[model samples]
Target: MKEITSTMAGTVLNILVNVGQDVSIGQEVIILESMKMEIPVESQISGKVRGIKMKIGDFVNEGDVLIVLE
Candidate 1:
């Protein structure tokens, strides 16, 4: 299994993948808003999305797991 984590503290602006969806390495999985800037979170490994740890509008910190994959 693999985890997709937030790169910085921010509010989740969008979730780009759903559970059971296949994802590739470097694929944009989530968008975060911080300091009025939109930052994209990408998957570090290719796999099927197993879970989403946060939803839109949720606040997340740097290093927090946002998505789980297997």
Candidate 2:
């Protein structure tokens, strides 16, 4: 399994893919709000979405896993 982790502390703003959905490399998977800015988190691998570790409005620290791929 592969995971997409948060690069910085933030609140999960949006999730673009659902569990079991196929995702491509570079596709925007989640949007994070940090420092009053919106940051888009992209998929680093092409695979099926196996899990989502965070929910909208949830606060996350740097390096926190956001999505899992398989």
Candidate 3:
């Protein structure tokens, strides 16, 4: 299993992948809003999305686990 973590503190703006969805490396899986900027959070590895730990409008801190892949 692979864990995807947030790179910065921000509010989750969108979630692009659903559970069991296949994702490629570098694919944008989530959009985050911080400092008035839209930041795309991408997948680091290719795999199926196993779980989502955050939801849209949720506030997250840097290094918080956002998704799990397998």
Model 3, 1-70: lDDT tens per residue? 8999999999999999999999999999999999999999988889999999989999999999999999
Candidate 1 residues 1-70, lDDT tens each? Answer: 7898889999999999999999999899999999999999988899999999989999999999999999
Tens-digit lDDT string for candidate 2 (1-70)? 9998888899999999999999999999999999899999887889999999989999999999999999
Q: What would you estimate as the lDDT of candidate 3? A: 0.95
Query: TM-score order of candidates, best first?
Result: 1, 3, 2
User: How many residue pairs clash in model 2?
Assistant: 0
Q: Return the TM-score for each candidate structure.
A: 0.97, 0.94, 0.96
Number of backbone-clashing residue pairs for each candidate, in the order shown: 0, 0, 0
The most accurate candidate by TM-score is 1
The per-residue C-alpha lDDT of model 1 at residue 11 equals 98
Query: What local lDDT does model 1 show for residue 36?
Result: 99
lDDT of each: 0.94, 0.92, 0.95
Name the best candidate (by lDDT): 3
RMSD of each: 0.6, 0.7, 0.6
